[model samples]
Target chain A: MSATHDATHDEAPIAARVRHVEALLEQRGWLAPGEVDERIDALAAGGSPANGAAIVARAWVDPGFRARLLADANTAIGELGLSMAGGLQEQQLIVVANGPDEHHVVVCTLCSCYPIALLGPSPGWYKSEAYRSRVVREPRAVLREFGLELPASTRITVWDASAESRYMVLPRRPAGTDDLDEGRLAALVTRKGLIGTAAV
Target chain B: MPDRFAAGDRVRTGTVDPPHHTRLPRYARGVCGEVVATAGHHPLADERARGLPSTPRAVYCVRFAAHDLFGEGDHAVVVELFEDYLEPAEREVRR
Candidate 1:
């Protein structure tokens, strides 16, 4: 039980502590030997940004579905048999649309809340204290740091996602992509696009 | 259950600081805003963190102008806050 880790022991302290805790749980019969690894593998595969890309692609092609998605995101998303819920309460998901004159960005001022089911692991900056504090106070400057420089006339809406709901940005469809199929359109969508930090 | 406010109604976030987990961020405390949408009930994350029973409370998307909260900016900020953290923004006595 007191044995040291292998030759490659450069893991971060917090990660090492987590592994140590998991090992203790496994020995105590609390966790099946491989349960932790199995769950992590499943989550990594299941919560990819491609999930959000697929939704965006569908919305770009189908006006009716887009209307429904914007009307009530959780219900509309559930219609596709996809869930956005996590933890104790039903984490309601909201879809905000960006347009020619309007843009939307999401941040969790208090914490790094996000739409993990659709957007996958959030970028480190999105969860940083600098971002969490500055985005709401100085959104344009923050956006500029992300290399997105919107026109002065455009209106930006910064959404502070909280315990009750998560927000996803519906980035505007890029010009000259009208002829592209849904699969091709989806391929062009990036995680940053879904977070309103970049254009598709 | 009836929500404390409806869409278009003016409201303000509360200022009390709970020692436990709270969805209300300090930046939004006491800030005035208007309710744009009503999300259904959910357990209080603050109370749940303390192992106390929390009834479902109505949550709302409150939209505040940048000028109102940050003192400068052209953009707007919308925060999703649960019922307990909100109160009616006292309307001025109309002429």
Candidate 2:
């Protein structure tokens, strides 16, 4: 146990602490030696912003899917062969749609809780204390910082993930893309748009 | 347990300042907000953290005006809160 701690000495404090805990779990027969890495690799492999983008593209083209997504996200995503059931608990996913009059943004004020299985890993800024606090306090100002300036007439809604449910923004499709296919539409959907920091 | 709140109900959050884990963020404590929707039952994260046995409780999406919560922004903040963290607020009959 002590040797494992020393073996991670060259790593950062947080990484070392994580390694120490993993080593302890392995030693106690609670986890296999390489199980943690395998799980992490699997998670990384499973998640991607493209998955979210594809869903958005489908929603853009299919009104029925869009309605289904707005009503129940987990089930709607399952229609696309995607799911929020990555780990033990199947987190409740709420899909908030951004409309001409209202825009939606997501933040985990307590921690960096996110729909990672959908949007891939959260951005560095999303986890920053500055974003966690300021976005909730002054969303328009923060969106301005992200180079997004909503019209004065537009209402902003910030979704704080403080419990079991997670949220994702369904950004309105951009204009002049009517000729584009679903794949092209998906290509236009950026991670920031899905997070509601930018318009897609 | 039955849902204690419904969509469109006015509720006020509890100012619970326990040292243990809680899903209710400090920013939302004691604030009055409207219940916009209900998210079905889930175990209390606080109880789970403390190793106390807990039954799943209904969660609600509570919406507060930015002017009410932060005093300046022209927006709304929606926070998902457990049933225990909220109580029926005195109705605001005065607009």
Candidate 3:
């Protein structure tokens, strides 16, 4: 009898339950009538890696801009008239630079806290417990596994962004691109590069 | 609006195992490190999460040696920590 009753439902149970939640929120004035649609629109347009790429490209071409970015990342990024502000999580963005002998990588051991506003959604591997646990303890081995083998002489510095200030790595510019413009340079910057897993 | 810690200042994370909302990560508790940069003050998200007023607190980027937290390696790890979660560690103080 119960099986027959379940099969007779016109709508899927999950869909019906969601509709019930929507109706209740609207009825209780907890959510304005079209708020759901507005949020969907906002989420769709947020978190693009192109934003971080552009910032990195500009820093590469202009030394002064790089200085400003290193000194105060949030303000320097704001000068571009685009927000580096995390959605619903107002974290301050810190730009870490990679040099000849020094490399920087970012991780949140407790949770996957990252600058989603600029770097876009985190990659699946970055959120894995294996990554969060092992990266800080054995960054060299992890990066090597990720195909970014570094020289023994080079030092790897990991940035654990655990608080209100998020971090992005300003990857050392790759060689043979001296003539490339900002747009071309930005094309080479990948999400992994910004996270310091790989170089640009 | 002044920052409590400046670059090069050595500090230690508080070991307060608060049962409520906190921004400090467990791995960083009581670890001593040098302040690498001053990121100014920001609202405490932990307090805000618990329905309490978020008084702005100074935050700093502190750099810790690999051995300090993980017990091995020559590499370093920098973490962003709030002032309330930190206190001054003993350093070379000249009279």
TM-score of chain B of each: 0.90, 0.92, 0.87
Best by lDDT: 2
Deviation in angstroms for A50 in model 1?
Answer: 0.8
lDDT of 1 by residue, A13-32 (tens): 77787888899999999999
CAPRI tier for the interface of model 2: high
Task: List the candidate 3 regions with Cα displacement exceeding 4 Å.
Answer: A1-20, B92-95
DockQ of each: 0.75, 0.90, 0.64
Q: Which one wins on DockQ?
A: 2
Candidate 1 error regions (>4 Å): A1-15, A78-81, A85-90, B92-95
Task: Please list the C-alpha lDDT of all candidates, in the order they appear.
Answer: 0.85, 0.90, 0.85
Model 1 RMSD, rounded to 1 decimal:
4.2
TM-score for each candidate, following the candidate numbering: 0.90, 0.92, 0.87
Error of 3 at A2 (Å): 12
**Is model 1 an incorrect, acceptable, medium or high docking prediction?**
medium
Pick out the ten consecutive residues of candidate 2 chain A with the lowest summed lDDT: A1-10
| Model 1 reproduced share of reference interface contacts | 0.82
